[model samples]
Target chain A: MDLVNVISYSLFAIGSFFLVVAAIGIVRLPDFYTRMHAAGKSDTLGQSLILLGLIIHEGASFISIKIFFIILFIFIANPTATHAVAKAAFLSELAPWKKDGGKER
Target chain B: MFLQVALVIVFSSIIALYRAISGPTIYDRVLAVNVIGTKTVLVLVLVEFIYERPEFLDIALVYAIINFIGTIAFLKYIEKGGLT
Candidate 1:
């Protein structure tokens, strides 16, 4: 309808697209590391974009402030969690998927 | 509208859930679960707008905290082979 609503809806659509990409990636990727790459990076961007759209819709308010905190937390925590999982998998000696039929060096 | 966005997110989450169920390794399942949790947060926010309930934002915030903590805890247990 208005400029703000158009912007917000476009942002929401973009975020949803990223979310779908991440989901498909997790399902289709060859290995755990790649899946984490998909999940961590795209998920963060998707959630941030979606939250940003909602914030814009809400304008300046206490609710938007809380949404900002959620975005901040996700920006900090999502990568950390992904790294933690990858580190644990590495430490546990989980093998990375290699294209060749030989062991990875 | 927000409801359509939420519907798409729910569909994607179901796809993620498939990976969680049939993943080749435990880490894949973990990654899928984390992905789903993040999507759930977005869905929760969209639902708040759909229902015109500002208060549910608090629930979304809390869920984000719990999701992060849960992932970290799961990684720790997986790495050390124990929660302690």
Candidate 2:
């Protein structure tokens, strides 16, 4: 295949892997805080990578520039949104998962 | 490859939707919804290329701004205890 196809396919594969990884983390992580660690980081990166692949395929179009903008927006917004959720959880005094050792902090 | 990426995004959407619907807390649901919104932004941009419609980028931009506003408003409401 040509380089465009190769790059696009690779990005697509990587993005899919990251997305699945985030999903697994969300399901298997012990608590909300830990789950955020998984979903926030993994999902954001996954979306960006996938967008990169597709934008490259689009190749020098105005739509491609807009795609990049969408990526930028997500890069800014996803983590901020996650932080807000986590902060809200903390400020509202939502309890974390109890440790197996029964220690409270 | 383009189609594959779209499929992956859709798969992630399913996962996020699960979180949104099955959350034990309101924040978790909101987080999931936010994730879905970000994914939608990417999806919209991709759709522009897929459909050969550059105008769709305008729609994506609008969606991005609206989604950000919606998430922030939700957070503000929660912070003020108005949502609870």
Candidate 3:
């Protein structure tokens, strides 16, 4: 309806779309690395956008501050978690999916 | 509108749960959990706004922190063979 509402609505729509895409990627991707790729990238942006939309919808309040902090924490921690998983798999000698039909381990 | 979006997120989480259930390796499960945990946070935020409940925001914040810590801890134990 208003500018703030319009902006928040669009944000929600976009964020939800990315979330779905991430989910699909996780389900449909061939290997752990690729699944992590989808989850890591899309989850970060999608979740942040949703939270940001919430803040915008709610206006300036203490709740907004709390959500803001959550956004910051997610931005830092989510990627760290993703990288840690990938690195651990690499160290463990996990084989990747190959295009020659050599499926993952 | 917020509720509709939140439901959509929940549906996405359900779809992602497929990976956790049938993932070939442990790390894939971890990845699934990580993605689902973050989505849960978003749902909580939307629930708070939709229901006019302020306390849910607090829970959502704590969940975000705990989710990160859990993921890191799992990875550490797996990679190092011990938490230390």
lDDT per model vs. reference: 0.88, 0.80, 0.90
> What 10-residue stretch in candidate 3 chain A is worst by lDDT?
A96-105
Instruction: Highest lDDT: give the candidate number.
Output: 3
Rank candidates by TM-score, best first: 3, 1, 2
Give the per-residue lDDT of model 2 (tens digit) for A1-105.
Answer: 799988987888898798878877776666788789876899889888988888777789776787788889888878887888899889999889877836322
Pairs clashing within candidate 1 = none
lDDT of 1 by residue, A1-105 (tens): 899999888999999999999889888887788788888899899989989998998899998999999999999999998998888889889888889746322
Candidate 2 local lDDT, residue B79: 89
TM-score of chain A of 2: 0.91
Q: Residue B20 deviation, candidate 1, in Å?
A: 0.4
Isolated chain A TM-score, each model: 0.94, 0.91, 0.94
lDDT of 3 by residue, A9-97 (tens): 99989998899999999999888877887988997999899888988988998989999999999999899989989999999998888
After superposition, candidate 1 runs with Cα above 4 Å error = A102-105
Model 3 Cα RMSD, 1 decimal? 1.3
